[model samples]
Target: MADSDQSSTDSPVDSREDSIQDSKLDKFSEDEETLITMMFNLVGERWSLIAGRIPGRTAEEIKKYWTSKYSSSE
Candidate 1:
């Protein structure tokens, strides 16, 4: 039925949104934070490379976290 087709189409999008939300909620473990800091020092804003060093972390998330935690407010 059309309803079933619509639900199927919506399922993947819903799951993707759920994953995004989950990632946003996920906190960086201490090891992850330390690794990110060390990697940033080594790589200097090459976020994708930094992300490669940290498991389950996206470049965007690492970049956002670093900027919020480390960037100067002034």
Candidate 2:
């Protein structure tokens, strides 16, 4: 019963997370790269701050983007 309860609550949350990621991927604009870079320089990798500056991106998505685009380890 407890497992069923947990599963019922979790599915919507998982779907919402997936949709947010989809929206970010679909709507990412070329201008966002410049904005993200400038904000990173000012804030130094604080993802929520960067996401607030750029509409339509969650902190998680922005973190992924920044790492993928700018990671020195790559």
- TM-scores for the candidates: 0.67, 0.63
Which residue pairs show backbone clashes in model 1?
none
Cα RMSD (Å) per model? 3.2, 4.3
Error of 1 at 9 (Å): 11
Query: On a 0 to 1 TM-score scale, where does candidate 1 land against the true structure?
Result: 0.67
Best by lDDT: 1
lDDT score at residue 58, model 2, on the 0-100 scale: 81
lDDT for each residue of candidate 1 in 1-74, tens digit (9 for 90 to 100): 99999989898999999888666735889899989989888879999999998877789888888887888878
In terms of TM-score, the best-performing candidate is 1
> By summed lDDT, which 10 consecutive residues of candidate 2 come out lowest?
20-29
**lDDT, residue 37, model 2:** 87
Query: Which residue pairs clash in candidate 2?
Result: none
Model 1 score (lDDT)? 0.86
